[model samples]
Target: MKIHEWQARELFEKYNIPVPRGYLCRNADEVRKAAADIAKPVVVKAQILVAGRGKAGGVKHASSPDEALSIAQDMIGATIKGIKVTSVLVVEAIKPEKELYIGFTIDRAMRAVTLIASSEGGVDLEVLAKTEPEKIYRKNIDPMVGLHPYEAREAAYSIGLSDKSANDFTSICLKIFEIFNSVDADLAESNPLAVRFDGSLVALDSRITLDDNAVFRHREYYQVDEELSPLEMEAHAADLAFVQLDGDIGIIGNGAGLVMATIDVVAHFGGKPANFLDMGGGSSVESVYRAVKICLEQKSLKALFVNILGGITKCDDVANGLVRALKESQLKIPITVRMVGTNEEEGRKILSENGIWYLDSMETAAEAVVKSAYSRN
Candidate 1:
């Protein structure tokens, strides 16, 4: 689960990290009031989950309260990266003498929480890792021992800070790591941690991604909102694992591994998958129908691929769901199905009777669906 920048900043404050005076504004009036309260030049930032907001014109400078109101009005209903912006963060725009990137996240390869720092900041860290690898400094903390103050200082100095500035930076790093552990977060990032003229550090931006598996431990922080898309909400309501993607072919499978493999297969055949929908074990006809209906509702979907290697979920049951859905719905997109386990013969017979075909080979089915989707396009 991800929180907006304003929420992340609140968390930072709780951890004793300094952040600019800011207000979470839901409307133009609130933005104007916040700008007046700050009594300084403010930055108006659209609060959306996706990145590249600055490049997408979601961040603007407001020199006066009226300007802040105007900026807020412009951003409130604007769409960025396909997500509608409903709120904006109005904060004092600090003029940083220097900018640095500092973050703590799980390094899957190292199997430890890694602290990353860089002299260069306010840009995509992935690009920096590829282009100027030397600029990126990394320290893998022993989870058993946790991050020590000395290690945090080492990271700070590695980024070329010294003296009082180094100490301040070290404190900020330690606090960020503390926040990461306390929140059971997968990632806690402060991009472009700004250094003011007085050498004080402030978090200009923050991002926190909590581990969904640990939500039960942090119930107070878990609140459902309109941040999720409609398809995501539907999947959540059905208790199915699903994620939307940017493509034309909708994918459905019985397990996570199977669904991922199906996506790879589709991509291998020069096809892009629209979504990942896992029906999970012991999937019923209703669940399958709902999944299919959700996929069919997606605009620009040329085809759907259902690959099920059933162990607990019977193949015939899946076939029954698909047959019923096709009969009841007016889905124009083509569908390719491959079922290979648990009463396969009965499943094939049912599909054949319903004027639908089943494939024995995943590779062949993937190729057929890719061709079918392209032909329609």
Candidate 2:
């Protein structure tokens, strides 16, 4: 879950990481008051879950309260990268002598936390990684041993830091890691970690992405307002794990690993999955029905795959739900099923009566679905 920049700033402050004085303003009047209180040049930054806000005209500098108010009035309701800006952060504007980048995230391939740093900041890290890979430094931090003082120092020096600046850099890196660890964050970043002319460092901008699986451990961080599409919202309301993707094949499974493997099989068969829907353990007929219904809600799906290795969840229940859903919807979209374990014979019989044959092998079903999805061509 991507929290607004102001929320990230609050986390930074909580961790004793220095940041420019700021106020989260929900209205132009608040922005005006914040600027007036600061009594200096300030930046009005649109607080939306979008990247490249500056290029989108969501960021503006104001030297006076009136200018801040004008900017805020123009900013509120403005859309950046398809997300409307609902609030703005007015902060003391600092002219940095140099800008740097620091971030922490999971390196899934390495099975460790990856610390990313670069002397070149004020730009997208992804673009920088692609365009000038040599300028950035990546360090894989082992969660067991944790980041050492020397390792942080190493990261600081890698980004061309030296002396006092290097020491400060190392400290901030360690501090952000603390926050990342405490919050179960998937990603934590401070782009344009500004070095003022007087040589003090401050986080000019900040954002954190929390691990959705672990967010329940930190309810204090939960926001009533999150960027969820209509389908996603519906899934959330139903207590189902669903993620919409850009493909024509919809996938539903009983477990997260099962769903992920199903998606991989689809891709391996030269097919794309439109969505991921996990029914969870001990799923009922109603749950399966809702999952299928939600999967069909996406207009892009040309085919559907239901892969279930029933244990706590019975296969017959899944089959019954599928039969009910397909018959009720009466949609022409093809659906493939792979069911095994716990009343498998009963499940197969139920599906066969509905003219839907069940497959035992996941790969075969994936291959068939891919062919079906492209058959219209």
- RMSD of candidate 2 to true structure, Å: 3.4
**What tens digits encode model 1's per-residue C-alpha lDDT throughout 229-260?**
78888887788898889998999999999899
Model 1, global lDDT: 0.90
After best superposition, candidate 1 residue 104: deviation in angstroms?
0.3
Clash pairs for candidate 1: none
Whole-model lDDT per candidate:
0.90, 0.90
TM-score of 1: 0.88
List ranges where model 2 is wrong by over 4 Å: 109-111, 140-142, 224-227, 246-249, 255-273, 299-305, 309-313, 326-341, 352-377
Q: Which stretches of candidate 1 lie over 4 Å from their true place?
A: 220-229, 243-250, 263-275, 299-304, 330-336, 352-355, 367-377
For residues 140-187, could you state the per-residue lDDT of candidate 2 as single tens digits? 999999998898899888888788788888899999999899899999
